[model samples]
Target: MRSKFQQRRLFEQTLNKIIGCNLKALPTTCLIAADDFNDEASFKRLVADLLAYDCRYFMTYGLVAEVLHDKIDEVISDLELGSKGILTAAHSDEPIDEIAWFFVNATAPEEDCVQYFFGFDDKAAFNELSRAVKKEVQKLNAKFND
Candidate 1:
């Protein structure tokens, strides 16, 4: 078994690899999607593997409008970090079509945040949504930099 330090190093390497892949392919955001993997299990395995590292995972459901409008604080507060299963159970009555996964680097600055967007109908939709998300993020950054 690897020591905690070794495990963390490995996680960082994997995270960097994912980020690099996204940068080369998409060039806008580091948001991985289910379609990015060979199979659903592979995508899910990545999520599970990342859970062992020093990160906080959260999922947001149907909050694109809020994000676009810059009500991100409300969306963040509504997320139950590390409790996607619980949130799904609580909202079982609704049909969950998409889930946006946030892997926040607990030990690093917030700018190192990684995201995975899942459950879009196709690649076109995913690309469109990612572009919108990237635009909103840029807006937020500009607001803070001002």
Candidate 2:
């Protein structure tokens, strides 16, 4: 198991890669947060800032597996309501709450646009990384918002 600092560093590194790769220019980056953490004013501000860049998706990552799973299920249902259910059905698996970070490029012609990053399982590390990510996001908001 990696140390808390290492885990947090991993989060920072992944975020930097996302930013450096010009994913922001593509404007498809969606910083997903669980509803438990989504109520924060700062988080809302970040989302608003990202929206200005033409990013349309704001995925809600529920803190628990069951809630996240249900949310995806509901999404699948909604998608099925339109065209064939085949596309959304791919995500019908169980909700995964163990990830530290992930990225998605919604504009891709293919559905395999999501890239997942699994952080250390240490709670302390996760908490530290979350805080670090929040701070970085807040700082980045200034650049994007302006």
Candidate 3:
């Protein structure tokens, strides 16, 4: 009977581990430098990085984010926060091929899992997708809790 947040968190964690299967030992917090960072969003995104991407990384510059402008502040804000790598990104030096391969290979199963829970969508569709998924997970969690 996991709570909704716990279930979503677990799903996100599971996805990161599965995606990082190719790495020898996975990365850690030393990759980032809050003291060096100056933006607020970068700070939040730094924390989000840990949650989203896990500790697994081939990064050293804390993560050279190529984030959209709106997301920029959040990334700056995440400067010192932590979690899995689901919210993380790669540094400039990291091989984009490796990341591309990671994303391509990791897509099917994780997509299936998400599709099972809440269906599919691209970025423009995510607003609806997010709402549906949250509501669904909440309903299921309520049932299990009952």
Instruction: For each candidate in the order shown, give its overall lDDT on alpha carbons.
Output: 0.28, 0.32, 0.31
Work out the TM-score per prediction.
Answer: 0.33, 0.33, 0.23
**For residues 1-146, what per-residue lDDT tens digits would candidate 1 score against the true structure?**
42222111111123224433222111011223322223444434443433333223323223242221122222323443334321111111233222211211221224323332223224453454444443443433321110
In candidate 2, where is summed lDDT lowest over 10 consecutive residues? Answer: 3-12
Candidate 2, superposed: residue stretches over 4 Å from native: 1-23, 64-93, 97-146
Off by over 4 Å in 3: 1-38, 41-89, 107-111, 115-146
Looking at candidate 2, what is the lDDT of residue 74? 52
Clashes of 2: 0
Q: Of 1 and 2, which scores higher on lDDT? A: 2
RMSD vs true structure, all candidates: 13.6, 11.8, 13.6
- Looking at model 1, report the run of 10 residues with the lowest lDDT sum: 4-13
Off by over 4 Å in 1: 1-40, 60-123, 142-146
lDDT string for model 2 (1-146, tens) is: 42222111112222223343333323233434332332234433443333443443334333432443344445445434324222211121323322212222232224322222212223343454355434443332312221
Clashes of each: 0, 0, 37
lDDT of 2: 0.32
* TM-score, cand. 3 vs. native: 0.23
